[model samples]
Structure formats: structure tokens, C-alpha cells
Target: MSVSPGIDRTTLRTTVAVLVGGIAVILDSTIVSVALHQLAQDLDVGVSTIQWVSTAYLLALGVVMPTVGWLQSRLGAKRLWLAALTVFLLGSVLCSFAWNADSLIAFRVVQGVGGGAMLPLMTTIVMQAAGGHNLGKLMSVVALPTAIGPILGPVIGGLILGVGDWRWLFWVNVPLCVAGILLAWRLIPADEPGRRVRLDIVGLLLLSPALVGLLFGLSNVAREGGFGHPDVLLPLVGGALLLTAFVLWALRRGGEALVDLAVLRSRPTWSATALLFLTGASLYGAMLLLPLYWQQVRGTDALGAGLLLIPQGVGSLVSRVVAARLLDKVSPRTVAVAGFALVGVATVPFALAGADTPIWLLLAALLVRGLGMGMVVIPLMAVAFVGLERPEVPHASILTRIAQQVGGSVGVALLAVILATAATSKGSITSAFDIAFWCATGFTALAVLLAFALPSRVGLDASAGGGTPATGAPPGPAADATEVGKRASIAS
Candidate 1:
């Protein structure tokens, strides 16, 4: 597949600017995770109450994400990005000054609104600028936060709380946000808002509540009883029904729909979307498991848990350069398959980790696991856009992102249930960890299976300009739809 020729200096600066913004959003997510305990004490609230520090943000994020496609079309990418940065910055300041639990949760909502829009916008900006050819490498740079945040967030949060207060977590976002806003204004090119700018108000209403209900339901299940409780069952069933209704509605609207379900007619897109979900479950599920093991099982403090995770981040960083270079040369199928296999292998040691497991051994396991994560991230991200038209990138981003986010919510819930169940047994902490690790392994294996859905080749005649395909080219439904179905059938 052709890489887009090197970008001009101006566009390069813009890309960097957008990447900085993307990193800021990632950093926020991880940084807050470490500060939950401190925030709870500061506000004199229970863990459950302070938990909304993250939950509120997540809820707002879910509510806002579906609107990104509509907003970008209405406001243009640059304007939307700058507006998001400005809002995020203000939210950070408000959070820093929050006096109580209720107030902090309120500010987090503001932060979420902006943060939710940031991710899709980030993907849209870089992908559009790259114009498709060198996507693997471009995505590597764009995906740096996935590698960086898990390593940096906990360490930074620990240090901040160590030196000052939990408020520092919010303060940390200040300089980053300021830098992001200035860079975005200076670097991002202006785009004319497209003519087809009608907002999908109906779809947004349906999708938003559906996502919120689903996440809320999962969080409930994570808390105590399973979905047997009315609280969980109501939202879970309602969310499912709402999502089903929206799918039916989206199918009827077709091209004019909010999500553009038509894109799934492409076999590669469908496979990539599935892989994204599994990756989220495998990766984020591990993320949830590791820190808890460190803090609860190994008796490490938050800082120590964060520090142990650094090795994994290092491995991920190392893999990025290699993965980016190899992406265009080899099929994503091969690269992604290898990546998930490595990830599954890395989890074996953790599956057997005991109370006295050596630090060096654990770090070694993390290094390899991190490497696997890097492998999965770059290829998965790049492949999603491989055969997509430029105009379709936003649609693809929304679909894959929704899959990953929902997957993460489900993953955390799954781990919660596993931990709760294992805790009830007479098994040692090591035995419990073994169980969670096995689940993580299974998830990675599923991702490996899903990778086969990706095309085995890079360049295809399906799209043009290595970026946007010809406008009037028949949609995938008209092009080998049966063949696509055959591939899925064969794989299953």
C-alpha cells in the first residue's frame, strides 16, 4: 500500500499539536485512577462516592462520544478540537478548586464532556492529514499515549500526592492543556464545514442513553450482586433494547445515519471492529488486574504498583518503532496475530504469581506483556482505516472506539466478578490471580482469532489516493459482499 508522501512542515506541526492534545486526554484518565483514594479522604466520603470522580467523567464521555461525528461535520475539525481543549482546560481548573465530593463530580462532568470529544477528534485529525499511505507509522506516533499513560500516570499521581495533595492531579492537566490549545490553534489547518451537516439528533439520543445505561449497569454489577439486582437488570436490559432499536433505526437511515452502519459491509472493517473489542478486553482487563494485585495481593502502595507497571510501558514503547516500520511491509493479520500471541504468552507468569513472587520476575513479565500491547495497538488502529475512504474515518473511529470503550467497561466488570468470586473461596491470593490471568489470556486468544479477519495484504484496489477512495465508487455492499460474508463464515 502507498504511504502518503512526507507531509509539509506546516502539517507536521499540526499533527504534533493534535498528538499533544491526544496525550493530554490519555494522561487525564490514568492520572485520576491513582488519586481516587486521596480524593475520597479529602472529601470525607466513601470510596463509592469518590469513585464518581472517574465514573462521572466516563458517563459524560459516553454521552458525548456519539456526537463527535455530528459536531465535526458542523464545526470543522480545527474549531471542534480547539473548543474541546478550551473546555477541558477549564474543567481541569474547576476540578482543582473543587471543595467537596459533589462539586468535584460536577467538574468531572465538564471534563468528561470535553475529554469524550477529544479521542475521536484526535484520530480524525491525524488520519485525515496522513491521507492513508503511511498510516501505520502515523498511528504509532498518535498512539504514544496508550504506551505512555499507564507508565506515567500512576507514578506522577503518586509523586504529586506525596508532595502536595490530591488536587495536584487536576493541576497537572493545566500546563498540558494550555500547550495543547495554543498548538492546535497555530498548527491545525482550517477546514470548511461540509455541506451535509444535519445533526443526527434521534440517533444521538438513542446511542447516548444506551451507552450510559450499559456502562452504569456494568458498574452496578461490579459493585456487589450480579445483574440479578433490579438496578442492574433494569439498565442492562433497557440499554440492550435501546441499542437494538438504534441499530434498527440506523439500518433504515443508511448513509444519513449517525453511525453509518453501512461501513460494516466491509469484511475488514467488521473484523477490525471485533478485534478492537477483544483487545480492549484483554488489555484493559489486565490493566485492572495488575494494580489490584500489586496493592491488595503483594501489599504494595499505589506508587509501587505504578512503578512496577513502568517496565510494561517500556516494552510497549520499544515495539512501536518496529511495529510502525513493519506495518506497510506485512499484512496487519500477521502482525496482529503475532502481537496477541505474545500478549497471551506474557500473561502465563502472572497467572501463577504468588505472594512472594520476585520483583524482577514480575517486571520481566510486564516488559514482555507491554511489548505485546504495543504490537496490538498500532496494527489494530492502522488496519481499521486501511480500506476506509477518507470520509469514512470518523465513522470507523466511532465504531471501533465504541467497541473498545464498551469492551473496557465489560472487562472491568468481568474482573470485578472474578475477584469477588475468588475472594469468597479458600484459595490463596495467588490462586485468585491465576484465575483472572487465565481470563485475560483467553481474551487475548480471542483477539488472535479476530485478527484473521483483517486482509492478508496491504494494498488493495478497493480505495484510491491511499486516503479517500473515489467518491462514487460503489459501497462495499455492492462490492463482493458475498465474498465478505464467506470469509466471516469460514473463519467462524
Candidate 2:
């Protein structure tokens, strides 16, 4: 059957199948944040020990992400997706049966292995299937988990904790994974196995540890004595050195590296990556602050704070269709600039407001913040792949995913440091939150500046009758693959 110029039935089914699995991963990521205290109490572990439940998951995720492109190439999309889903299902079941903090943390790492691969692989498969047409609309569909996860994850966690045992948290994922695996088997097309690609062992050694070190160091900022602590400084510095080594190594290996480093040369690719970093810091860093602000300053409980944040989620949801249309009609630059500016403006109220600022006003600001986030994130994600060929899309997805993940970690750490330093003084929690919001505002402001570097319109080589090579006239195969692969690998 001939597919439409836009999304087709097969595409929609593929997207849905991917999203079903994707949602489970997303929810699991955030849902456990609220359960730390409960888990600590239940397991008879200190807060510090129980916290590894989240930390171990994050570190495992960072370690696994760099391997996804190679793994996908080795296994094909359908097999990889089912394997990841099954691993997650197994991990979730193991976690539910954990008898101690040590066991749970180990189980969480297992879950992270599955989740880390699923994150980038989801995008790789979807975009490859879409063949790079109607990206703006497709991205809106892809972004649904990210938009709702922050707002709803905590609420769901709270509800689960409110009624049932802590183990139910992991148990919830069982049904989702089961359903996801069954649906994927029924819906996703099978791929013919390709020739085995040798794993980039040396590059993997350098890059995976680099990511682990960096994420571990960043995760310690709030708990350790800020950047000055040896615990934080050693890993952060070590990670940086390893990452530098990996870059040099990848450059030397060229297309053969675990992650292709050549994609950074593309103006659109690098620019979108930079913007995604800032967006991550702004979105996630602010998320760290918002719930705490309500709970600490306003004295709302966890569930209440989550409920209050629903306006932001609602705003994001409402704006998706409109933002998708705008992306199709206007330049991504225009939409992104406007979106970041809106985010900056919306954040100013939180930065300047007093503790007693009206509830309705804060909620309204959240709505606008959500709207701007939708606008900024959708286009930034779509623009990253605007001009790329099919094979390169997987690498680009991995690159963008890494950018956003690292960005969120950095953002959270920076704000955490700021809040910690500010809180030590004899001022109220409100002042600390205000200062953090100002810092977040600074991030959006920077993103607005960077968005100018994004492609002014959709598609690479638009003048040459823009579309994927599959849709338009194909380019010279050898030259196009080499260049595209280089850039895509670099970006990944």
C-alpha cells in the first residue's frame, strides 16, 4: 500500500506501539522520586542508602545508552524493542520482590539497563519508520510521554503509596510491559537481519564510564558538599577527562567509532543539541524546584503539589496541535524564539513573587510555561533530523537523547547548588526558590539566543525539493552516507 505524504495507518500504529512502551519507561523514571521516603521507612534503610534506588537506575541508564545504536544494528528494531521490554518486565518483577535496600538497588539497575536502551531506540525506530516526512506532526506524537510524565508521575506514585505497599510501584510496570510486548509483536514490522557490526570496545570503555562518572558526580551535588566535595569533584573531573578522550578517539575512528562525532559540523544538528541542553536544564531544573516550592514554602503535600502542576501539563497538551501546525507553517527559529521568550517571561513571576503570591496566578504562569515548553521542545527535536538520511537517524536520536539527559542533570545540580547556598542564610525558603527560578530564567534566555542558530525552516536542502531521500530524488549514495553518517554519529 502507498503511504500518505503525512502519517499513515501503519505509522500511527507503530507510533502507538512505541509510545505504549515509552510511557512505561517515562513513568517509572519519575514515579519513584516520591517513594524514596516510604521505601526508606519500609526497608529499614537510611535516606542516603534508599536514594540509590533512583541513582543506580540513572547510572545504569547512562551506561547502556551509548550501546543502543550498535545493538539496534545487530538485533534490528523489532527484536531490540521486544528484548528491552522483556528485560524491563523482568527487572520490574525482581524489584517488587526485593527483601532489602541492596536487593532493590540491584534490581533498579537491571530496570535501568532496559530503560536506557528503550529511550533512544524508541526515537530511532519511529523516525526510521516515518522516513523523515511530516516530522513536526510526528514529533508531537513522540513527545507525549515527556509532556505528561513530570506532572502525572508523582501523582500516580502518591496514589500508589497512599493505598498499597511500596512494591506495587514496580508491580505497576508489569502489566504495561506485558501489554507493550504483545502489541509490539502484533504491530511492528520485522526487519531482515543485517551483517554484524563489531562493538567499539575501546570507545565504549571511554564513553560509557565518562557518562557514568558525569551523571554520578552531578547526582551528588545536593547530597555531597556541592562541587567542592572530593566525591563530586573526582568523578566530575574524571568524567570530563574520559569524555575528552572519547571525543579524540571517536574523531580518530571516524565512522567506525561507537558514537559518530562528525555530526556536530551541521549547524542545525549542533544548534538543536545546544538548545535541547538548555531546555532540559530549564524544564527539569524547574521541575525539581516547583514541587519543593509548593511543599516547602506553601506547605502542600506531595500529591497536592503534583495536582497543582497539572495546569502546566494541561497547557502543554493543549498547545501540541497548534505548535505542530506552527512548525509546519513557520520557521522553527520563529517558534523556538517565541517559545523560549514566553518561558523566560513566565518564569519571572516565580522569581520575583513573594511567598503569598496568589495561587491562581502561579497556576496561570505554569500553564504558560507548559505552552512554551511544548513549542520549544517539539521543534527542537524535529529540527535535529531535518536533513538527515535514514541510517543516520538512529545516531541523531541517541545524540539528542544524551544531550537532554546530561542537560537535565546539569540543570538540577546547578539549581540544587544555588538553592543550597541560598538556604544556608537566615532567609525564608521562598528566597532560595526565587533565586533558583531566576537561574532557570537565565537558562531559557540563553536558549532563546541559541534557537536563532536552528534551521529557519524544515527539511535539509529544502531548495532541492525537500523530503527524505526515500521521498525525493536520492542523492549520490556513497558521498551522502559518509557525510550524513559522520554528522549523525557525532551528534549521537
Candidate 3:
């Protein structure tokens, strides 16, 4: 079979398999937001206690993410993927049966451990199989769940709660998990394991807690005292200290470290990390504002607000092919700059909108915004791996994931603070949303400036056997072996 300019048939199949499993994780992330209230009431716990169901999951995700590279190295991708799927499935079943908030929170942590590994590993395995080619196209496929999750998660959650019990939220993952495992077993190739690879225990110790503390602090920004609250300040400060220690420790350990801080030396890698941070802030921060703007200022219900967000999702889906084509033809820098610029321009309407602004106009802007976001995100994710080697791909994935996650948390916290402060001073809901949106626009505008640092071309040689550099040049011995395996799999 002939391959397209980007993804081939084998790569497409692999992407589908991973995405099928990944959809449950993506859906679960946002689906629970709408159910928090229902869960609080059903479980007979305070909203604060029920909130931990989400918090514990996030904390577990942070703890497990940095350990993925080490785990993959020891277990190999196929084995690790299967193991994580099973764990997540088990967690889902346990969560479905939880009789109280504590049990649910514990089960959710198990789910997070599985999800945290799966999220980045999904990209790692695919990029490895693709031989470093057609990343833009591949990412467009990978990004589908991310783009749709926020839009559809709440709707699905609401529907489940509307007619059925809250436990259905966890139960919903069972079929997807089972199917993902069966497909993975049948399709994904087995590889030689790094049996001699040793875990970086010190790095894991420092990095995991560091991420947990930081996320814990950021998660509390919505409480009564905001960032000044004791809950927020203590964890933030402690997390900062732990993170500082990890940086120093990782730097000292060099390539032997759990995360391989040395990967930042690659210009494309670091630039992508920076852009991911900004994009996360822009994407998630805006998400926080858009929903509230509709419900609070426009006086719509949650379901109504979710329906209105559909245009944005539609626009995102529409742009995937175009953006992927552009990335392959034009270059990541060009695509990313244009994307962020479009997003910045599109956000102006929201920044200036009043309480009575026309819904049609707002929806139109959201469509444009979604298109821009698609362009921005796909290229950034693709380029992060462009110049990296096969071994370096895992570290690159972890770094980008961390950047985006932390960036989203920071973005949400900052925007929440801005909204609170503005609402108090102005006593007008519309004005507060306007200010919050302006802050989100600022994030995208800054992202535009950083996008220039991305590679000006897609240089990775997909045809080269073994891990080829993004320079589209001859491959090294290790990359050659890697490429040989990928091609052999494809040919078979």
C-alpha cells in the first residue's frame, strides 16, 4: 500500500489503537467536572471533600509523569502500555463501586497513575513508529481527543447524570479500556527491553513531590483566600524548593537522570516547551472564561453553555487537515506564528464584549479561535520531537507534558484571580469577564512571539532507518536500527 505524504497505513492503525484507549482518559479528565456537585450530594460529603476526587487524580498524575521514561526504559513500550491500560481499567471498576468519597478519591489516584503514563507514552510510541516523519499530521490525529474532550465531556457527563446514576461516569470507561487492550495486543509490536536500565530513584523522589506540591498549590487558587490562603502558599513554596532541588540534581546526574534535563539543550525542544507553556495557558485559561461568561453574564445554564462551545470544537476539527498539510509544507515556525496571531486577533471580541453582545458574533469568534488553536498546538507538539533522537523522545515528551500541565494550572489560577479581583472592584460580571479574557489574549499574544523560535522547516528524514534527526540527514547507528524495526513492521 502507498503511504500518504504524512501518516502511512501502519502508522494510522497504531494511532487509532492508541487514540481509542486514550479517549477514555481524555473524556474522564473533563467529564467529571460537571458531576462534582452531583457526586458531593450522592456521596453525602461536603463539596470540598468531593473535590478531592479530582484533586487526588491530578496529584497522582503529576507524581507518575516523571517516572514514565524510567518505566518505559525498563518495561518497553508495549508492555508498559498494556500494564497501564489494565491499571486504569481496574481503577475505573473500583471507582464505579466506591461507596464513599475517600474510596472514590483513592480509586481515582489509581486511574491517574495509569493516565499520566498513557498520555505522553501515546505520543512517544507513535513518533517512534513514524520514524520522526509527518509529526504535524500525526499530532492532528492525536489532538482530536484533546480538542473535543472539553467540549463534549460536560455534555456527556450531564446526560449520564440526567437519567442514570453518578457511578456511570466511571463505568463508562470499561468498554473503551477493554477494546483498547485487545487492539493493542493484536497490533502493537514488541521490542527489546532495557533490562539493565536502572531507575533514578533520587530524581523521582524529588520531581514527583515537587510536581505534587506545585499542583496542589495551584489547585487551591479558587478557594476563599485565593493565592494568599495558607493551603496555597505552603505547598507552592515547598514545591518550589523541591523543584529547585530536582533541577540541581537532574543537572548533576545529566543523561543518567530520570528526565534527562540535557534534552533542553536542543533549540527546537526548548522552544517547543516554551510554546507549550504559553499555549496551555492560552487554551485552558480561555476555557475557564468562556463557560463562565455564558453562564454568569449571559444567564445560560451549564448545558446551554456547553452547546454554545460546539462551534469552537467544530472549527478545531475542520483545521486539522489544513494545519497538518501546512506543517509538512511550510514549517512549524510559520504555522505556529500564524496560528497564535489568529488566536490573538480572534479573542479581541471577547475582551471587548458586553453583557448583551450578540451570541452569533461570539460564536463566530470561537470558531476562528478554535482554528487558530489547532494550527498552534499541532505544530508545536510536532516540532518538539523534530530534532530529538529515539532515546531522547521520552524525555522530550515528559518535558512538554509537564510544561503544558503546569502552564494550564498557572493560567487557570491567574485568570481566576483576575476575575475575582475585577468582579469585586467593578461589581459587574461582564466587566470581570472582559478583563479575564484580556488576560487570556495576552497569553496567546505572548505565544506568538515565542513561536518564532520553532524550526523553520520539517527536516526530519522519515525514510532514514533508525532514529533520524530532524535535520533530514543521514541517520546514526542507533537511529538506523530503530528505523529498520519501524520499516520492517510497516512492510509486514
**Candidate 2 lDDT over residue span 218-324, tens digit each:** 87777546798887899999999999999999999976788886767667778998899888888888888787778777888878888999999988887777789
Clashes per candidate (backbone, < 3 Å) = 1, 6, 6
Q: For each candidate, what is the lDDT?
A: 0.76, 0.79, 0.79
Q: Any runs in candidate 1 off by more than 4 Å, and if so which?
A: 1-10, 460-492
Q: What TM-score quantifies how close candidate 3 is to the native fold? A: 0.92
Q: Model 2 — TM-score against the truth?
A: 0.92
TM values, all candidates: 0.92, 0.92, 0.92
Off by over 4 Å in 2: 1-5, 460-492
* Poorest lDDT segment (10 consecutive residues) of candidate 2: 476-485
**Stretches of model 3 off by over 4 angstroms after superposition:** 1-6, 460-492
> Order of candidates by lDDT, top first?
3, 2, 1
Candidate 2 CA-lDDT value: 0.79
Q: Model 1: what TM-score? A: 0.92
